[model samples]
Target: MLPKLGTNETMPLQMTVGLTYDLKDDYKDAGLDPETIAELDSPATIDGLEAALRQMGFTVVRIGHIKNLTKRLSNGERWDLVFNICEGLHGVAREAQVPALLEAYQIPCTFSDAAGMALMLDKGLTKLVLQNHDISTAPFAVVRAQADIDGVSLPFPLFAKPLAEGTGKGISPLSRIETHQQLREVCTTLLQKFAQPVLVETYLAGREFTVGLLGTGDRTRVIGIMEIAITDTDGLYGYNNKTDWFDHIQYKLLTLETEPALFKSLCTLSVQAWQALNCRDGGRLDIRCDETGQPCLMEINPLAGLCPGFSDLVVLAEMAGMSYQALIENIVNETLHRYNLPQPRQRHEAA
Candidate 1:
């Protein structure tokens, strides 16, 4: 059972939570492409999370965008804390925007801070950080413009993706470039489609996994590792595959009990990346095996998707015997504890 606070719990102030996120409709209004809007949090997610917070004795407020947040907080309005999942509409620093604002206002928020989110979203920079720390990741280079791709040499059978994008954006089977022409075509396409720099890395053709992590530093724990069998994804976990994953793909618990060494190594590397990136509260890491049958880091998501029944992170936790509510509670409780506040017991109303 999760730990609970006692009657003598310190700092017993009634909690109020501010929920912030970009909605799909918000993107529609701005004339963003439907595919791009897929990154935005669904209404059901906001509702489910708000209901959970209310159930836990928190008064909740919905702040949809920076404009509304500015109006409220500028007028001296504030919540005890903010539950932020705002995938900003544009820019490489999109994921960090809300958290940056929260820090400036001195209001605590859930998940990672600005620096952590920024680092995780930038794939090439993230790999560099991991390499500097001696954590194994695929060999990679970045292509900012078409000229940069000229005479480029990393390796054959390379993978290209947007440097800063989530929800499988800018990724497709065509992302795997086996020749110079394919590399030039895909990188140029990604640069146009996402309007961001492209990351070109050595392709890891082995099995892929997404690991859910909770807490921070020594307290961090691997919730579970989810094996993603991209059966119909043309050998790549591309955009369509992720969007229609339930229909076309398979999800499985991946302990690799027979290969205990690989299993243990996956867990260890995930925690290493989490700590190296200074991730707090909770997050997810994408791990893929190298040509040598050893697991290597791909990317980390400090701002992991939270689509209730649909998100892979939630599925991973469920595979490990945790409910969606419990998964959310873990994030909430971890954030509270980080502030040195006692956790409230699971609240139940009178029958």
Candidate 2:
């Protein structure tokens, strides 16, 4: 049995954690565009996570991806908990594939469940849920084809990107459409290139911010808010900007001490959105301001990347004075608390 919290009973075993992820190199020779595999983890990232989990006293097992996991399960293998970050390569429900499988096998995993993952991945679907919950989000439309672009009621000067992509895929300076012709061209290009519906929303002209959050439900709270300032006038913090952020972007950390009203509003809205979507553990919500500077939800990443120095979540955590190991530990502790499992001892404390 797993150890329980608040008890002095000696336990004979440590928790065994299974790690599931998709590596970028796994698909390099598949003749796919770079953006298609942008969300996959680097080998270094998996190695870093394994080292951290071991440092935290958990036996870590590396499970490659959905196919590997399926084979492992067929062999009658299981773990106390799974640290799943598998971003499946197909369908609108790709991100939910691993979690749903684990759910069927009666195994628990970190982060949001299947339903939440599916909803959050599709920008249009997520906005619909946010609208129902009265959360502030930009008006948007999903265009599946050229015919659908004509039906977009949203005004001109809109931004367009793939409906279910992350890591700024299908986004660029041209994403901001100033004319109907531009809109059609951009949407058509994205539709053909990604083979997915496109999401076109009103262009948020003010500043952009991404809030880092932790915990579950009512316990969810903002860890930090980092403003993404683009140095180039035409930059949109899209694929190019994100890929070369050091040269074209500036990250300004915000806090209640610096911007009290804005900070509180962002925190409140972020937590409300997190709960409304039933998201658990830790993640991030991207918010950008309208012309009037009111923050609006752009998208939610329940499975935020964990590539240590490269991921935005880790960068924000460092800005908030949290070490990489501490950020991982906090996520693990929150998951453990949610599952009613005893959290491991802190690395600095006596064993």
Candidate 3:
């Protein structure tokens, strides 16, 4: 049970927090595609996360990749909690390494636990989990190869992409298939090109936004919903869009104008997804509207980005009136609270 804060009492000195992210050095051996590795070392995301934590007065230490991450923790390095940002080394299980290590060490951390990471990383499984819970997700099917696309029952105009990669690795405008033959070709490309299962889902062709949820359980807070305006690009946030293809001339961002009804719905769906996966600390839940403007789950990003200016989560935080410091502080406190760490008495502005 969480401890109730008593008035007129000082919390103790804050516990040390550690940080880990995919390193530039590990890019080659991380088993990711060459192009993918380049983006993994983008520094903007991991460095931004560390900078924010340091500003919160936490003694943040950065470790690179999963190579020896587990061994290092076993060697008596004490951390009250780990801020895990490892997207993974290779395979669908990549995102699960950090949390699994931390959990084995009896140390707490932020973001989704190992199982949640595994489930969410596999988009096909994620959809099934949501469907099993009766949560409305995009209608979808899984194909192991191009030949397996014959019996897909999803509505026309489907989206096909690698079911397990992140950062929009294999997605492109070509991923959108309007006919059965097109769908088969796309699915085959994903399977043969990536050697992974392809996820085919009913495309939601409306607004794109992410719901930022922080903390967990009874105290979880919805930071704010961020709308993605991809006007300069084509219709997809595919590999090219992520790589800044066409310099974003076709991409643009739209304003919700702070629609109250939409905001509430985004919050509700994000929280439901978070709770369904038993996520803790913070994570990002992706939502999209159908042609009729109804919100549905697109996917959940357990390891959301923290790029100083580019990350959607930080962008949402900025809009929600949270400085980077406060955002990091909240994440730290939430993690500490999970393990019942004694609260710190003093509030110091970290340099």
Candidate 3 achieves a global lDDT of: 0.73
Better of 1 and 3 by lDDT: 1
Across 23-113, the per-residue lDDT of candidate 3 in tens digits comes to 6556665465665664455666667777766666666677666766666766767676678788765778888878888887777778878
Best by TM-score: 2
State residue 37's C-alpha deviation in candidate 3, in Å. Answer: 1.8
Root-mean-square deviation (CA) per prediction:
3.8, 2.3, 3.8
Tell me how many clashing residue pairs each candidate has: 0, 0, 16
Q: For residues 315-337, what per-residue lDDT tens digits would candidate 1 score against the true structure?
A: 88889887777888888888987
Give all TM-scores, in the order shown: 0.94, 0.95, 0.87
lDDT of 2 by residue, 1-351 (tens): 254455666433578999999998878888878877888989988998898888888999999899999999999999988999899899989999999999999787999999999999999999999999999999999898889988998887799999999888888888999998999899999999889999999999988999999999878978899998899778587877877788988999999999999999999999999999999999999999999998999999999998878788999988988877888888888888888777787763210
Q: Which candidate's lDDT is highest?
A: 2
Q: How much is the lDDT of residue 204 in candidate 3? A: 86
Q: Which candidate order results from sorting by lDDT in descending order?
A: 2, 1, 3
TM-score of 2: 0.95
